[model samples]
Target: MAKKDYYKILNLSRDASQTDVKKSYRRFARKYHPDVNPGDDIAVQRFKEVKEAYEVLSNPHLRDQYDTYGRTDLDSGDVSHGTTYGGADSVEVNNDVFETDVDSDIYEVSTGEDPYSQPGGGPEPGSDLSFELTINFENAVYGAEREINVPTFRICEACSGSGSAPGTKTAECKTCQGTGQVFERDRYSGEMSLVQCKACYGRGKIIQTPCMRCNGNGSFQTYEKILIKIPPGVDNGSRLRIHGKGTPGVRGGPPGDLYIVIKIKDHEIFERHGNEILCEAFITFPQAVFGTEIEVPTLDGTAKMKIPPETQPGTIFRLRGKGIVDMHTGARGDQHVKISIVVPKNLSERQRGLLYKYARTTGEL
Candidate 1:
């Protein structure tokens, strides 16, 4: 096979930073990992290529050699001193292939560059936020609108998130030449790598005069009151999404999304399974003996059900379309009611006499 360009294989520029290399490696590895793309020959081959590229590019000495002499340095060159490259397919040596101090089981761990870093100017998207919302069972069955307070970062109105004091200007970061990144050579291996400039916090500019209210942070933490519309048929552990309601992004990036996790409180009268509702209703002995109509509680309102003659206890009756509705299909599930016979505990004198007389007439007069 012809030699592949390590940078091209990783989709990185020649001057990409160590963090960018690691981040790209993680992204490509995760997408093409054998476990993720099971039984796919192409993915398997691509995963091998990514791992090989990362192993070579991640090491300072090896990367420097590869940059100067290309892949030929692995065979024989001035840059091949302590660097080693395995076969075209796999990690051949038993020693550590990665020298970045990251986990050896790279696939199991999340290793990437700062998600908030923006390469082409502007800020990266804010991190996604999660909030658990506890709601009543009725609200979960029938939709409800609830007002909630979420703690998050909001843009600093004092300086409009620019971090500079009013009437002051931002100066270009000299350390990174307005790129927000600095290149440094390793002391031992003399290899070059990119790192975020500490002075600008990767902003490519410096706030000469810090904002007094936000202290140059560009945002502050405060409570935001938002009305969340809970849809019907949402169960416990269900998640509702509200876009652009999360933390304020850095610089001019778009805000992140807010995820509302539903925690349905237990109901006193009903137990829900998927879209179906289950409950138990007690009927009098006379009602069970002779056919009678009884009222049962449903999510909507009271529903009348007919109890058949000689109906035994523990008989389950289903009322169609009386349960929760499906969120996607709009189809409703059935409400199942289990029957319980309630026998009379105490009898009046007339009632006892009537029962005794009836028994005597039937057999032992």
Candidate 2:
């Protein structure tokens, strides 16, 4: 049978969002489920078809693979193509603009037929995987280039993730009986979680001969080298999105994303309070009294500052454009130099005598 566009089956676009895929599936199911349609075979088939489409494209990884490979094997419950590995084919989104991330555990299980295809069940995508990444403090701050290793259940290239060793047809799931979703009716139990048939792991087909590399799971856990670019000036708890980098979705669904969460390390000498930076500098009594020239530390390097005569301890001197850079506006904040006067621990007799003389002259002897 010629392949059907699973997107149209679910009444969703090929580029529909995850939410849209889910909503479309729910609507399709409501209209076609056997319980709802009451023995309508056409509606039953449509329900299975829409469900298959939702299973794949909703996942980012699966969708990317499907988009790239354009394989119609999913309709026959064939996972014949293993993942074509590469990191440059990744997706990236700017967080400063969107500023949001989502964490979810997605499962893509195919059963019975080509759930998303033009055939009996429809078309479907591939499986999805999930994992977590931890970034460094400085990397989180300046954004960095890094390579990481991850695990995924990619399709089996040998037998094509088909779980079949070679050119063998997989059997339809007996529990769900290729329907993918098993219906349960209990007198007391009002609603149920619509358990995916465990026999096929919710995929309507069973592998006759499993692939050696993936052990019939259709994928392996070998880590791939992935290099990522972190953006500049991302604050702590910020998230960087790498598209098409998540686990492979079903035969045709979209893949998930790699969410890089920024964990900025606190600076030892400087403390950041919003847009401003605060630090303490010790000044001698003469510098405070006579208003002398002092070198102050700022983001742009060292600058000569005029200490006003009679400047007391704890005096704050603002240095324009010297603090932390603003991520949004690109404007800089002023560095607040808080002066602290330190008294010398040891005093010479000559200095003491001079101080006594000056004190007497000042009428404070």
Candidate 3:
């Protein structure tokens, strides 16, 4: 069977940006979601297809593989006729066994079939998983480790993923006589083709007794606790990749990856913009008039900042290299302090007199 064009499925062009892909996927997903179109098999199938397309296109590695090889199964040996081992002439050698030498390796060729073509049983890559993690502001700035529980699927432990009960055996499929295939004739063209047997689903065997734990499904769902390392300088919307920590593979295929989307909690005193930190400090009128030092809060505790003489209200001071560290470049950012002048609401008579005298001397009263 021909592979579906993912771009078409998403109603996008091949050059569509990642943002475009995401937008289209969300639109299609909402329209065809199972809850929205309950009892509609066609809508359910469309939703599944859209989800599959999004999964492949949203990943850079998988998207690149799909673009280059026209498929995302990176480990599969199947290729186009021109790229096959025996070249164009090898297309007709489906049932013929031939030896080919490439890079000092000899491979025996057989009928061209997808490694995962069998629906009943075959090695299939696991689906990638995503989760959102919210960390403290300090943790986002300086790195921390956390433990989280993720619910996912795993191979059944009772029957060791065999789908058979303990001390039980399987029987050959009677539909195809253990061949796992049956001949089907096309109604219009009257052409015959060998297709997978529906009874055994191409596994050629049936479990006489199903495993009580997994119900002969070969896998089960459970919650797994995992320890994750969060790097420094992770801001809101930051993504971290954890390899082989997603859903377990099927039939011994490789497991998918886990993606953690980071959300930084808002700080009580500090506000972040990119790598820079913004904070406010209030000073008395005298302190702003005559230079004075004040303590300012920082990630490493309070630090002293000098208030220059005649500093205007809303004046900003920069403390170099006191902000967050860039995770990619390893460079530090600066912290900015905005100074605000405060006037005493309740003042002693002597203080008020001194202030009036100062204002008169400065010609401001």
Candidate 4:
């Protein structure tokens, strides 16, 4: 079957930029995420397709491979094809981008087709992977570098991802006579149907001595440590891309990317909206009655704001340029401090008399 074009799946042009790909993914994922479309099988399936398309299109290496080869076979990095493996291709929209049931689509399959064969030395692009990184609110505001260990696949160093032992080579598969697929002639319909050759798993070749390190799969699981930088003004759900840090590509293909999904912890005193911050401040009756300058907490540092005389509770004061920095533009937002008047809990006799006297003087007792 032919593979679905990832650019079409993401509603993108062949020349779309990385930023465009990201924007499209976010817009589509929000509409089709399982949480947004509960119990809808079609929506669930579409969401998965959208995710798969994004996984391929968002990464530079993978997108290039998918474009050049017309397939996204990251595993074992087989880049020697210009046509999709099977005639089994599907539609543009509402297509199943991730062909999990068909291993030949995502991985190597034995083939007699020389044009599609991946020689022992060609670079196979790696699969793109995602990780969710939880960070403190302050770190998101101030920006910080963090080290993380990602559990993913890397090309086998021992076999160099060829699936054969060192100094050895793969032999042509015999089941399909070097053809990666088998054909059956139906008498009644007079139809010829093609099926993947199981002998060499459609690779049209067999590795007599598989690499012991990777067991012929050409990749292994390991944890990789990477340092990622968090940009200032990043809030929860911000996504950052780390190129060439994901699953390693096949044979000698370039590594895939690691997408970092940000999750900022809730702050104790402040809540963020876009680049702005909202916080609550408490002032005594005297402070509100006589206009005073008070220190207010900001993401940067303490800032002084004036409370006008006769200030009312629930009034919001704007502290310009004291909120989070704009991630893209580098501009700053204002901080909104909501005022809450604090009344004395326990009144002494002298305090109660003073308040009454003061109220009477103001003609409000």
Cα lDDT tens digits for candidate 3, 1-365: 25778999999865454556888999999999999998999999999999999998877556645553457665443333223311111112112212122111111111112223344455656655667777777777876666667766789988877789988988889998877788899899999978778897667789999999999987887877766566667677665555566667666876765656677778999999988999999999889989899999987889999888999999999999999987545698999999999888989999899989989998998
Error of 2 at 326 (Å): 3.4
lDDT of 2 at 115: 31
TM-score of 2: 0.54
Q: Each model's C-alpha lDDT?
A: 0.71, 0.57, 0.72, 0.69
Better candidate by TM-score, 1 or 2: 1
Q: What tens digits encode model 2's per-residue C-alpha lDDT throughout 159-191?
A: 654556676677887777776667655558876
Q: How many clashes show up in model 4? A: 18
Q: Model 2, poorest ten-residue lDDT window?
A: 102-111
Model 1 bad stretches (over 4 Å): 1-122, 157-210, 350-365
> Clashes in each model (backbone N, CA, C under 3 Å)?
0, 40, 0, 18
Model 3 Cα shift for residue 292 (angstroms): 2.2
Candidate 2: regions farther than 4 A off = 1-143, 149-154, 168-209, 310-312, 352-365
Clashing pairs in 3: none
TM-score of each: 0.56, 0.54, 0.56, 0.58
Clashing pairs in 1: none
Ranking by TM-score: 4, 3, 1, 2
